[model samples]
Each structure stands twice: as structure tokens, then as C-alpha cells.
Target chain A: MGRHEFLESVAVADCAVEIEGDDLDDLFATAARALAEVMVDPATVPATVERSLELTAPSLDLLLYDWLSELIYVKDSEQLVFPVVEVHVTGGSPCRLTARLAGGPIDRTTTALRADAKAVTFHQFVLEPRERGWRARVVIDI
Target chain B: MKTLPVGDCVWEIPPGEKPGMRVPARIYASEALLARMDEGVFDQVTNVACLPGIVRAALCMPDGHWGYGFPIGGVAAFRADTGVISPGGIGFDINCGMRVLRTSLTEAEVRPKLAQLVDALFAAVPSGVGSKGFVRLSGDEFDEVMREGARWCVRRGYGWPEDLDATEGGGCLPGADPDQVSQRAVTRGRDQLGTLGSGNHYLEVQVVPPGGIHDPRVAKVFGIEQPGQILVMLHCGSRGFGHQIGTDYLRRFDQVMRGYGIVVRDRELACAPFGSPEGRAYFGAMLAAANSAFANRQLITHRVREVMGRVFGRDPRDLGLGVIYDVCHNTAKLERHTVDGEPLELVVHRKGATRSFGPGAPDVPAAYREVGQPVIIGGSMETGSALLVGTAHAMTETFGSTAHGAGRSMSRTQAKRRVWGEALIKQLGERGIVVRAASKSGVAEEAGFAYKDLGEVVDVVDRLDISRRVVSLVPIGNIKG
Candidate 1:
């Protein structure tokens, strides 16, 4: 299992989060979950819809960016708020990843959107492996 | 980095202060603003000075803050023949800008109906996360919007002919090629034409309060002569479409920059030669996104006019709902400017800055050419926003650029921790400002305490003669995205 927490000082105008996981897959899954919460309260969203995303990137850093960006596209295009995120990752020169996000169209009456995470910012973006696990920091433009 | 006071409200860092810097970096700010500026702004602005083919100096306006690549309120110009273009310099929301409209109604007339008007607008305009727009567009029609911008909206009866004339560049940036934009961008943006995306975006109904007119002469020329005159100010951008375009190019540029032998200290500042195939694609795609933003604001304007007409029992035209001006805060354009007494074409990037073309410049609309292009600078809804006019001094000092707003002085998380949105709403209501936000948390994040003093920032430029003050607008009604 992985965990994430919001950072207060990393970004002044947007939301920043730091995630920790036991491995690459856990790290990516944690990142997705963190990204999801930044936009809306996940607890209020029901896991009624399913979306599958697959992408490849030259670096793990870019792989994470692409995954989060793809989700933003889907969320904006379909007007869905994902509460559940599942990510599978394979580390290599060209990183590969697939995600399954479960959510549905936002019912404004029931949901309180915190912010519109417009895009993932590369400012101070970091992804690294630690002795015990992995850690990544992401700044999302709200 | 060591800096010297170059002029009143201006500080300069020589090229020797940083490795790879080709020119000096200048900060257009007051002594107090300079002292409080975050270190990241200094670092980022100096890094911008290192880019290949930079002209004169990289500039940080008074409202500057740290951003992805260039600082917010940053501007830089590059040689058209040899320089490069990076999405980082233009920001995720392409042409994310400000627009102001003048109305004949007075504060006295609007005050009684302020709550109803705000609520109607809040319901009519889609906002917040995962918000979709009312006007749906097919793939082909969306493409036309990219090419024709606000003109297409008028052609579709969403706007009037005169609206285009008040818009910057007639609301259509040239060289927008639909083919250059990606499918994902179109999918994300096709339906978002009239939406105000969350995160500091808003539509405010304001009035020129007594003593708010800083330059009475220019205010009269700009259709804001009276203190009680009402105005509608909208802040938004291209939405998901531009965000997708910026993301796509940032990744693409990172991959191809090494091939072009271009190196930037930060990967976020990735770039390729302006003349390269890669660069050409992004430029066209960016212009398309910029045009979409123009059309988006125009669509929102149409909705606002409809709501106003419905509320006040008069046609919008009869109410004198005319666009005063529309301006972009995030953009990169190729324009001809003189450098060191030589005239040359340059690609000027304004990330969180506005173009302040002074009086008599050919680009200024003929109606405003003698008075200067109107610049709308939005502050927090609780504090007041301002209307200003450009000056020739800006043309010489900052590539005709000026600050966009009072940049956030506190982090969103900190702001949320400090105040409860539920309480902030009541606080604002007591102050006589009606606010309707999609989310309470969003409102808290935008509390005036989290932002710098806009008056001080405006004073910096006013004193420097970059952008002169015209009128200050106090919000009577606001709908936060």
C-alpha cells in the first residue's frame, strides 16, 4: 500500500503532493490517487464508471506526467470524477504503464469539487527510488 | 544573484551573475516588492536570461512569482531567425487572459438585484472540476473556432460585430492550423468553449466607486467615465484544450531539444530552434489554442449578456453591454520590435504578463489607438481590480509587456489551513460583495490574504509609466469558477 500527503510550500498557486510507495507500481498508483483527490473529494464520488488508459514514455518522470495528463483529459472530456485508481508499471528505458480509473459524471448537488487540477506542472517535479521504497513529488496546476 | 537599482521601481542583474546568461535580467518592481519577492522568481528570471538568442534582458513584472519555467509576470523576446519557443514560457492555459465589458447600468441599479444576477450567472456558466459547457461543438465546427476565433462566435450569432473590434487581434490569432493540434486537445476542449475553469478563475460584476478613477481623462475615453458605472470582468482561458497542447509540446520538446543541440537548465524549459519543424508545429498548435480561448471568452460574454437582459428587463444592447477590451496574459507571438536601434522580428513570450501596446501603435484598435490599448488587471474578488492603459515606456522597457495580477503570496494549502471557506463567504457578504462559488474550498484558496497588495504592484508600473492607471473596479457581484 502507498500513501500521499499534500505539501504546503512547494507550490504557491497550485496544489503539490508527495507520495510514497513500496515499489514502482505502488508509487504510480499512489500518484494517481493523489491526483484524483486534488480535483474533488474522492469519498463523495462513486466508483460507478470504468476507464482504461495505457501510455509509454521515454523516462519514468515523463511516464508519470503522461499518465496524470491522460486522466485529466478523460476527466475533462467526460466530466467524470475518479475515486479509484489502479496503476501497473514496468521500469525500463521507455517506461510503460496502464491505469484503471473508476468514477462517473459529477453530480454537482452531491459533490464538492475542491479545485480543477488543470495540468501537471514539471516545476520541481521529482521521482526517485529510496532504500526501502519510492517517492515522488508532483505539482498540479489548480 | 547580485542586483543593482537600475531605475525607479526597477532592478537589474548583470549577465555575469549566472552561467550561460546571454543578457541581464531586470525586475520591474518597487523596493518593497523586490525585498519580498521569492527566491524562485530571481532564479527563474536569471535562467531565462541564459536562453539562446535572448534580447536585451529577461523581465519580471511587479507581480512576478515563481512559475514552471519563466516566472509569472515574466517576459522575454528571442530572435525569430535563431531563437526557440518553449511551452513553458507560454504556460498550460494558452491565452489564459482577462476581458472587461462596459455597461450602462449604474451601481444603484445593480445593487438591488446583485444576488439574483450572481446566482443566475453561477448557474449559467459551467465551472469547477469536470465542468462541461452548454454549447456543444462537433469536430469540424471546433476546428473552425480554432481558425476564426471570436469571429466564428459572431457568425453563429453569439456575439456582435463590434465585439471583435474591441478584442485584441480581433479575437483571432493568425497561423492557427487545426492539423497541428492533437486529437486529445480537441476532445478535451471541443465542449469547453464557455466554461470558466476552477482555480482563481471568475466572472465579476464591478463598479467604478468614488475615487476609483485614477486617470479621469483616460477613463472617459475608455467608456468608464462615471464613478457608479457598472462593468463585467471575466478571467479564464482555453481550458483543457490548451492544457493538453502545452503538455504535448513540453514532452515533445524535451525529446527533440538534444537533437537540435539546444540545452536548457531545466527540462521544463525545453525548446527547439524557432525555425525547426518541431517549433513550427507547436507555434501553429499554440495559436489554435489561443484562438479557442478567445472564442471561449466570447461565448461566455454572450451568456452574460443574456443573463443581464433577463434580469434587468432590457436588451443587452440597450444596457450598453459592450466589450471594452480583451487581452491575453499567457502567450508567445512573433512581432517586430527595435533592439539596440535595430529593427528585427522576435518571438516574445509573456507567461503571466499582458501586452501593453501604447497609444498610436498600429496594433491598437483604431478606436483606442490614440488613448492606448486597455489592460484589465484582476485582483482577488475581495480586493479591487484595475483598468489601465498601455504606454510607450512599456514598449521600450519590456517588449510592450506588463504584469498580469497580484500573484499569490501564500500556498493554496496554507490558505486552506488558515481560513474556512464557509466563514470567508459570510465575511465577504458583510463587506457588501456577493460571491457564489462552485466549491467552498476554492473560495478559501482565493481569500485576499493569500495574495499580494495589487495596489502596490499597480503603483510600480504607474510610476514607471509602463501601464498607466485608468480606473479601479470594486466588485459588487462575483461568481468563482
Candidate 2:
């Protein structure tokens, strides 16, 4: 576990975020939490349902993009919000990821929907190893 | 970073200014507007000039601003046989556009009941984050919507057949193959057909003020004969469906780019050759999403008409609720344009820009052929909007394209920090503009100061003769997602 914070980008109309962790797996998990926080208050989402996803992408940056995009798609199409997200990454080159997202159905009374992130844009998108941890910058198209 | 003055309100970066740029990059802006623009716009437009098969130049409109790859208000044309198609060039919101409907009622007649009408409209149309629409489609029917676009809605009684005539491309782009659309995209689109998704999308009730009409003859042709005439303008597009398509294609194109031996300065500009298998597939899928957007707007129009009828106590027809025009700001259309005095088929990509075909163009509807295509430019709620008609100069200089809106001058975060949503709402209310939105923070994010002035942007295009102003619209009420 590490830290994730929202950043600012003059190039886009929506939110930009920076996530860091001890390794690739940790960074992915923290990034998911950051995305969840963007949509609603994580404290309000009840972790009553669980969804598991296996995704693959050509590169690490794209893997993060696909992960976030899948979460957004699930949030919109299934009407579910995830409060807890776990990611496990293995192998190399074309990386593989297995993620488990736990949350409940969205209810206006409990969930204060903040923003609907349409997709993760590749504009200035980066995922790289930094001193002490792995750091990534992603701009979410809202 | 260097540019030379090419014409009044125009600046150009020569082809050799960048190492791989095949054509010049042009920006249409007054000196004041250009001074306010972010430097990223220059980088993005110049990068676009380097794309494969880009013809003549990569052009930015007066309202241009930095975007992902192509600047917002960016326009370019590529040779049909040699050029490539990129999702970034068309944008995530496929056919994200503006539709304006005129009514016989005047502002004076609706002023007292403005709030009530706004409430009715807000209730009728599903809006805000993750909101679903009243129309739920089965998987099979959803496929039909992807194929037939607004025509599907007309067949289902959502809109009248004549409404399509006022829409660009007749409210549907041909060559849409439903099978090319992914199941995930379809699933996301199924319940969101008539929804106005969040972030700058809105439905507004506007009035033509006494001084708003710029040209009396053109205004009359556009159905704006008298001051205080009420009109409804809606800005929206394909919801989750287009987002999914854009996401899916960007990733696929990035992976395939290496095989095509194509390299781009930005990964977001990923593309495939127009004749390539990947390019054709994405084009088909993009058209499906474009059609989905047309149907979404048509259904929303139907909802607006219903609300108006209820509020006015008259049939929508009797109320004179007829569509003046619907034009998409984000799209890539294959059309014939003359390059170097030779007629050639080209794929024109307009991201955050509008098509402004001049009078007598075959694509213009017969009713408007003598006046040219009506271009709808939606400004922020506080500043109001404008209607302009294309000129022959637009076709010759910009491939029949023009500015889409008063582009953003500040980031959302900056806007939110500078303006309190509640206070801004109060200010607008004091000015006789009723504003309703899902979130106050969202309202603040789109504060009037966050965007460039519409008047200046319109003035530049008008002075340049790219698009001539017809009328201006002052907002009376608006609903934002």
C-alpha cells in the first residue's frame, strides 16, 4: 500500500490522478481505490457484492487503462459501485491481471455520485518504476 | 513554436517547421484570442499535421483549445485512398452535437412559467451521472438503433419523419454495421439512449433578443423572425456507448500500429490506414456509435416536445416545435472536397468543430440549399449562443468546417476553486436565467468565466467570412447533467 492523489492537467477537461505503491500490483490496487473515490464517497459504498475480472493489455500503461475502463463500464452498466478493489499481476511482456471488486448497488440516498468517469485517456498516461515505488499518472475523461 | 501570419485572423506553421509534418498547421484566431490560448494547442495541432495522408493543413478554429491529440476545434482532411483514420481525431463522444428547435411562443409568454417548464423538462429527460433513460431497448432493437439512428426513433414514433431533414447527414450516417459494435458497448448503450450524460452536456431554453439577430434575412430563413422567439437547444451525444467504442478502438489501434510501421508522437493519436482492415472495422463501428447518438438526441427531442406540450397546454405541433437544425461537432465524414483544384474523395475529421457547408452544396437540405447549412454554436448558459451559416470561403479554406463553441479558458478544477456553484446560480437567476443541475459542484465546474467569450469567437469567424452569424440566443432556462 502507498498513496494516490488527484492532480491537475490543463490539457483535459476532467480529473488527473497520480498513484504510487511498493510495486506494480500495489500501484494497480491504489489506482483502483482512487478511481472509486472519484465516483463516490468510498465510506458510503457497502461491500456487499463482489465481481472478479481477468484483463490483459499489450503494455503496463494500457493494462491500467483497461482496468480503470472496466471499472467505469461496470459502474455505469451494472449500477454497482466498488469500495474495495484488489489486483494481482503476474508474468511479463503482455501482463495478466486478476482483480476482485466488492461493492453494492447504487442508491441515491446512500451514494453521493460525484462524477462519471467516461474512460481513461492515454494523453500523458504513464506507468513507470520510480525510486522507492512504482508511480503512474493517468487522466480520466469525465 | 514559430508561426507566420497567413491572412486576417489566420496564422500558419510551415510544413518544414516540424521534422515529419507533411503539411502546414493553421490556426484561425484573433491576436487577443491567440494570446490567451494554451501552448499545448500549438503542440497538438502541429502534431496533427504529421499524421499520415493529412492533406493541405491541420486547421484549428477560432475557439481552438488543447485536447487529447487533436485540439478541440481541430479540423483536417485525409485522402480517402492514402489517409488513415484515428479515433482521437473524431473524439470519444461520437457525433456529440447541438440541436435547436424553434417555437412560436415568445419569451414574454413563457417568462412567468420558465421555472415550471424547466422542471418539467428536467423530469422528462434523464440526466446527470449514471442516469438511465425512459426508453429501454432489447439487444436486437439496440442493434437496429445502431444501424438506423434517428430513423429508428421516427419509426417507433419518438419523432416525426420531417425532423430528419433538418439534421446533418439526414440524422444517420450510412455504412453502419451493427455487428461491428462490441457487446460491452451495446450493454452500456442499451438503457442510456435518451440520457444526457454529465460534463458540459445540457438542454437549454433560449430566446432571440431584439439585438441578437445579426442578419434579418438569414434569421428569417432560420425561423427566427421576431425578437423574444423561444427556442430549445440541446447538447449531447452517444453516452456510454461511444465511450466504450473509443476506448476499445484506441487500445486496438495502439497494439496494431507497430504492425503498420506507423509511429505517432502521442499514443492517443493511434490510427490505422483508411483502407486497412482495422481502419475499416473501426469506421463501421464508429458509424454505429454515431447513429446511436442521433437516436439518443431524437428521443430526447421527443421528450422535450412532450414536456413543452404539457406545460403550454397545446399539442406540440400547434406550438410550432419544429427542429431548425441539428449539427454534430465531433465526427469524421467521408465526402468529396476539391484539393489543388482536383476533386477527390476525402475523410474529413472534425473534433470539437462543426461542418459549415456553403449555400447550394448538394449535402444541404433542399429547404436550406439557398442559405447554406445552419451551424449551431452553443456557448455557456450565461453568455448565450449563436447561429451561423456556412460560406463558400469555409469550403475552400477549411473543408467546410468552423468553430464548435467558445472553448474552455480554464480547467474544471480552476473554475471550481474560483466560483461557488450556489453563488453563480444566484447570479444567473438574477439575470433571468434559471439553472438546474444534478450537482452544485458540477455547476461551478462550468462557470461562465471558465470559458472564452462567445462574442469574440463568433466575431472572428464572421470577420473572416468562414461562417456568417445569423442570430444570437439568450438563455432563459437550462438543465445540466
Candidate 3:
């Protein structure tokens, strides 16, 4: 019901939502789930391939973009859809992130495309941490 | 359902007509034609009214549509002292427009040779995305193209110098300073000249209908006919060169406006003062792009003439294939117009609109001064294209501008979802129109139903006497990119 709270409370853990676990992990996992939902139907993904990935970006906005774009690359090439369970944001030169994801072969009929994104554009995009949780503000290039 | 008469075909919104409008808006559509506009059309028109330096009104042409900063069929001439130039105004494919050619061949003689002629044209002209042409240029040669426009191609024997007479700005804007263009733009443009890039760009063959003939004597001189005479029309622009030029300038202008303390309601409407360094830089680059587009079309015309000759087994000279007119749709030109009583040098930005200067206008070419400048409007593949001439009415109404084409009624996604590409192709083929496209999906995106009926748009403009209808050309064959 509360869009901001829902976006903030999303977490990551063990490649799936840890409903009764740490807030940060659950938040990252939820963000990944949100991304996966937009890309394709998570229910249809076989979850056969276990993938571990890391990314670094200049800002939280860039971090979200890098994360989403990287996942999109994997979706296009590997035909894998990943629903995150755990995510750890570690500080580095830019900023580093580790995530666990799940996905499998793509089936177009059963999966509805949520958006027609040509490419991620650099418009008025921003990512920042809020008092309650992490928040990302971005406009998808459609 | 409500119409506030502005003047002639123009209608005013008067500030609070719609919500979120910082200023009033105007639409250049007759009451009959305005009724057929898409429901969301006013929304997009009002959205533009909220932009910065939008001047007296946010004007929409008969062919209006929802687009990024401004609607596709919208035009707003921002004040030179304060206005902004949105990339949305020029569009992603900068300077994309139409070039019409007249030929000696009548419909009867050309109809039989349609297949061979289409084949020749298809093979001769490179189409589709990433499609390259037989002609290629290096960075230096490309720079020459940016500076000389169609003349560069003519000097190389692509076409005759006379062809320049029928082109807007004589096929090259005078103030093209190549130094303002970026190296990346040069690189992208170097190989793309004379090539028809993908999506909505096309080379079409049509038969001229007899009845709507204007200046039959002159038409006779040009070899245009009454019911069925074959003609060639090319719709394209500067391609990657123009894209890169617009991109480079849009970003530069976006940042440059900060120095001038100028702010717009929308970032897409980013701009700098007309006299500022960035504004001059953008103008120079835009001109260079316009030149590249002119040269590209000139080369394509030459190839088309060659192919017509090869297919007809007669010299193209005898075939009477010559340029009727070449014009750009999205561009900003510097011209002198009387503001109050004294002539003032003004920067006129005509986006999705064509310059329709009437007879006796000094700016119009000498050959066409008697009949006025020929304005070619390329319609949907199913609907035929129209030939129009400038009218005296347009001079005071809309800065001598008229609607460019049948504006899109729906987005590509909606069109694709509703219509299948192959089915649309077959439908066209059944209607005696042959179409060749690079991507099937792309074709679906451009389905005739995706846009307003061009016939209606042209009719409104003609009825209003903004531009006089000269000819309606029904397509026989088309190759789309």
C-alpha cells in the first residue's frame, strides 16, 4: 500500500526472500524480485542455474542501473531469469555488490513483458539512501 | 469537442483549457479535421505549453501526436532572445524528410515495367538498419558533404546543379561551419551518406493522379500527367550523421543553458541563448547535418535515375526523370520576416513542419517563384503522397509552414500489438502496392492504421488554403528501412 515503504523494505538473502531475516538482505532480495517481475514471470523460471554476481557503480542510481542492465544482459544472452534471495552491498573504489540469483530458459508465451525498454537512458536518474531504507529513482528508457 | 477559433485553421487553448499548461496553446487544424484528432492529442499539446520560452502559443499542426518534449505534429517558434531548442523538436532522425522526382514516363508505359523498376531500385538503394551503400566516404570527404550539402554530390556527378533549384535552402544551409561538428558525428556520418537508414525512411514509386493538377502548363513542362503517370519519391535524411550531430548538440546545449541562467519546464526542452557560443555551435552543427542530408538524397536520386533508365531500357534523360523538389521536415533556419513593420532577422524553428513560402517570396528559387515552392508530403504506405504549394495565407498564419505528414496516432508498441507485419504487407500487396522492408517488426510499427489518415490531414490544410494541393501520388512500389 505504501509505495516508498514497500520499495525500501525490499531485501535479499540466500537467493530468495528471507521473510523473517535481516532487513538489508531482505531489501536487496526484494529489489531483485521486483526487477525479475518486470523482466519476466518468475514462476515459470526453472531456477536450475545458480548464479553469483558482483557489480560496482559510482552512485546508488548507477548501482541500480548496473545491476538491472547486467541482469538484462544475462537474460538476453543466457536466457536466464534470476530472483534474488541475498544481496550484500560492500564499499569499494566505486561501490561493490554481491548477489545470489535464480533463473532458467525463457518462454515468451507464458511470460508477459512488463515494459518495452529500448535501452537504459541517462535522463533525470537518481539513487539515494533514505532514513527508513535504500531508495532508487530512475526512468526507464521506453 | 470544444474549439476556440484562433484564426483561419488555427485554434487557441487560452491558458486553462487544459490542466498543467503554463501558457495557452494553438492547434493548426480545421474544426472538421480537429474532431478526428486522437484523444490524447490535447494532452501532449498542453504538455508542450508548459515548456520554457514557448512564446505566444504551443502550436500543433494538423498531423499532431504524442512525443517527448513536444508533440510530433507540434511547432512552437521560441523567441530568439529567450527560447529553447528541444531534441524532441528535431526528433531522433534529424532532418528526415521527402524528395519528389518527376519523370517522362506515363502510367501505362511504367506499370508494365514496375517489377523490374522496383528490383533495380531495391538493388541500387541500400536500405534497412545498418545497411551500407555502394558509395562510401572518408572523414575528409564526409566533411565536404557537411559543408556543401547536395552540391557536393552534384560536383561528383550524382545529379545536376539544376536539381539544387528545387531543394530547400538550395540543398545546403549557408552558415554550415564544419568546425562546430563533433568527431564522433563525423565518424558516424562518413559511411552513412547516400544510404537510407532504417525505420520510416523509404524510396517509393507512385502514379500521379490527373485531376488535382496545378499549373498544367508548368506541369506539362515538368512532365506530370492527369490520371496515371509514374514518378519516384525518396523519403530519408542525413542518417547517422544527423543523429550524432543532434545528440552532440543536445547534450552541449543542455549544459550550456546553465551559464545563461535559463531554465525550462522540461529538461528535454533544454536550450541556450541564440547568440551564445553553444547556440551558435548547435546552429553550425545543425546546418552541417542538413547539408549531409541534402547530399545523401541527391546521391540517392542519381542512383534512382540510373535504375529507371536500366529498367525502361531508355536513357533516363529521355525518360524525363528530374527532381521536382527536396525538403527537410525538422530544421531551424535563419530568415528575415517583418515582425511589426520593419524586417527582423529571426531564427525560425520548423519541427515536423515544412516551409511553404508563397509566390514572389525572394527566398523561393527563381524557377518556382511563379507557382510557389513545392512542398512534398509523404503519407502512409497505403495512403498516397501529396504535392502542395505554398499559399499567401501561410505567411501570416504560421510563419509560412504547413503540416509535414500524417502524424502517428498510436505508439509503435500499440501498432505492433494490434497489427502483424506480414499481414499488413500482404494487405498492401493486395491493394497493388509492393513494399520491401528491412525488419518485419519495423513494418508493423509503421502500419497505416498507426497514424491519422493522411488524406484528411492534407485536405484540412488544402481547405484552409495554407497550401494548395497539386497532385496525389498513389504508391506502386516501396522499399522501407
Which model scores highest in DockQ?
Answer: 1
Which one wins on TM-score?
A: 1
lDDT per residue for candidate 3 within B385-457, as digits (tens), equals 8888888877766677888888776655566679887898898888878887655666776777877788888
> Each candidate: what lDDT?
0.90, 0.89, 0.69
The residue pairs found clashing in candidate 1 are: none
Please provide, for model 2 over B274-377, each residue's C-alpha lDDT reduced to its tens digit, 9 standing for 90 to 100: 99999999999999999999999999999999999999999999989999999999899998999999998999999999999999986798888998999999
Candidate 2 whole-model C-alpha lDDT, 0 to 1:
0.89
Candidate 1 residue-wise lDDT, B272-347, digit = tens: 8899999999999999999999999999999999999999999999999999999999999998899999998999
lDDT of 3: 0.69
Per-candidate DockQ values are 0.78, 0.61, 0.06
How far does residue B215 in candidate 1 sit from its true spot (Å)?
1.3
Looking at model 1 chain B, report the run of 10 residues with the lowest lDDT sum. B260-269
Candidate 1 predicts chain B with a TM-score of 0.99
Poorest 10 consecutive residues of model 3 chain A by lDDT?
A8-17
TM-score (C-alpha) between model 2 and the true structure: 0.98
Rank candidates by lDDT, best first.
1, 2, 3
